[model samples]
Target chain A: MSHSVDTWIMALLTLCVFSFLYRDNPFYRFAEHLFVGAAAGYLLAVQYQNVLVPNMIRPLGRGNLLPLVPLALGIMLLGRLAEKTSSASRWALAFYVGIYSGIAVPAYMQAQIFAQLADATKPWQPGWGAINSALILIGFLTVLAYFFFSAPHRGLHGASARVGIWFLMVAFGASFGYTVMARVSLLIARVQFLLRDWLGVLPGA
Target chain B: MDEALDVRWFDPNRINLLVGLSLFILFLFVNLRRARRAPSGLYIRTLPALQALDEAIGRATEMGRPVLYLPGLGDMSEVGTLAAVTISSRVARRVADMGCGLLVPCYDPVVAVLIDSATREAYTQAGRLDSYRSGTVQYVAAAQFAYVAAVTGLMLRERPAANVYMGSWYAESLFLAETGNETGAIQIAGCDQVTQLPFFVCSCDYTLLGEELYAASAYLGREPVQLATITAQDWAKILAAIVVVAAVVATFFGYTDIDKLLKTS
Candidate 1:
């Protein structure tokens, strides 16, 4: 109930986790198991409280027969834990997979492929933005051409795909540069932590 | 200002200083008295493995086989992806030197483009201006398994001598490693994802685990600022650990009042 006790408890737990860094000793092992156990227990409690009782049983009790479908699905999902009824879990898995695939496939197609093409093709009207747009179009067409698998390597589409390949190459190169900066930042963050907080020799601290 | 800093239960300033100092002293002692000799590259203030990366490429070139570089499954926003790309720059340099073709398969569009630039820059820097081919780097599907299938196909088709997998990965870690193994390529992998390490360790020749993935840039001497940051983070971890032990011992001995005071203070 007390915030101070809670804080100390958290600090102890954190220390247990950090203990692993000093060569995987018993303290780290104990902490790791404790964390796994606590997490599983908490998840179980939350599921029962949040999902099963309110969404299924309560609705059934209120005479909404429509709740039977969800109730059945919920029970079927629990089949995963029982060897005898494990086959029933397949339906639940299928339902989940179907929903996920339905949402993801279309979303990815629209975002990564078509949208990129649209952005790549906007005609420039003799301004800086237009010039950039034209450059982007050239890059996209050449890069896309390079990736072309179905069409012959002789026509305008082939030529555009080649250009798309070029754009893609440049894009990947820029991405590589940005990635260098990001990784370097993480290393910098960690070093700063050690020097400023751990060693106290770093002047900026 | 003095009174404002003197809150007992929740004094951020004092707690920060105490935690900072405690960790600093611990590591200072450890580093000073360390008698255990680690693997030559692992214990150093600066990384030595990075230097050998060029050698890996040279060997690949002598063998007359393509080099396979995987930028991982995530976007450039991921720390692991960034490390992979940074390492890729070095690898690209070596590949250009050898005039060996470099094949980079990307799972993210943004990352795909970034790697393309890095490949070109490395080639240009090596004075292989005309050698930079756009087709060498390509984007596979963003779907994890689809990306895996495409990469596996490339691995089979190219039969690269050296395989480098770096960045954020998930279920496909084993798939890529096992495929690379089948081709008998010298595979080096690095990932910050702890769950994927066991797979990489089992499958790859050299595996960089956890924080090591983040340290790649520093290891390669990319920036001095990164070295400073890592030192600071390590200090924070050590200080936090000591406070934890003290709290536990205090609680066990029924010094609940003292623990409470410390926590609240």
Candidate 2:
């Protein structure tokens, strides 16, 4: 009995969320506010448990001083919301930027440029590796040629980027198809609700 | 009447089932009244979103301004990036033809290069190969706020007449939209961020909601088969909703055997 009642209450909550689609009625507004409050409350609780307690309060309580670094950094991030003290936030920003840039800039060059171009170039080695590599190289070169912006398009760079146009077209086409699948899946999930869950009719029925 | 059993209301599956059924019913009404088209037939239609390039480019030409297009925050895995590229292809062609400037600031380097190519190729395709600007498409830092700052700086420096935003967006959606708004540009935006839809609606002149972003090329390109697929997907939605409602009803009212039989089949 309780199981079914629980199902009903959950249904009611979900229905409240979906109600927004019909021009934001009172029920939908209620649901939206409830959701916002719940989300905020949950975030506060999680941050307290995960970051504050373990990373800050616990350390200070246990006489561990090293945790103060992260504790101070976290506090500085809050300075961004304040007007006068916002300049102090830059120290945190610069710290993050330095660490992030250190990791990202090199990773991008090595991964996107060096690795992709290398793999694209070394197509004809010895075995199937040669075949796949050749294909990748051809595709990359053609696409690169299609976008060749630096030099005038009188010769090979011009021709390669033109081939790049075809590769780009194919990529866009595949992306389009996949996007449709995703949209259809969401629509299907919603529609399935109305059918099996609400009406309770199916193959067996 | 056991309180312990009452706590079962928080069960994820039970909640999901009820919620699903409710939404399915709601969409049934939402889709039923709109238009009547055959399921299998194809219809080609044009949306002004494509013409937006012509307008944006024409404005840039008239005002001697640049056009700024940002491919959202996500990398290539995002559908928004692909949509932005397709739109950029058209915009680049127009900008090339009009002899106006184009600026594309991208979050992802891979996507930036691709967008740059798409922009350059648009010029090449338009026979304005000489007009294709190498500096037109460039990468900004990948961090969310850093990318936003970089894009905002470009908008301020260039002072574009028209801003086009297409792709996956999150927290930075409003930041970009609001910045574009401040610049007094005619902003045309499309995104799949359901949470950010309201922001776009409030800030942008033309906003594509939810699945509309995915249907952009088809609507803008006026492709018949693509339109047909869109219709099929709509019908598929109806079919899915009916199934959900049925599942919920079976799961309720002590019809466990019926639900099991339906599931097995």
Task: Judge the docking of candidate 2 as incorrect, acceptable, medium or high.
Answer: incorrect
Q: B113-168 in candidate 2: lDDT tens per residue?
A: 56765776688888998877667787666566556655665676678999988888
Model 2 CA deviation exceeding 4 Å by range:
A1-205, B1-41, B44-53, B223-225, B245-265
Model 1, B174-262: lDDT tens digits are 76898789889888888877566667767787776555666666556434444443444345333333444454455456543432323
Query: lDDT score, residue A173, model 2?
Result: 58
What DockQ does predicted model 2 obtain?
0.01
Instruction: Tell me the tens digit of each residue's lDDT in model 2 across A1-205.
Output: 1235655565676676566445335675565455545554665687789978887888899999998886687578567456587667657655754565455533433443334332332214456665764565567545544332223455766676567657655654565456557657976876565445554453321
Candidate 2: what's its TM-score on chain B? 0.74
User: What C-alpha RMSD does candidate 1 show over the true interface residues after superposing them?
Assistant: 26.5
Assess the local accuracy of residue A114 in candidate 2 as a C-alpha lDDT between 0 and 100. 37
Worst 10 residues of 2 chain B by lDDT: B256-265
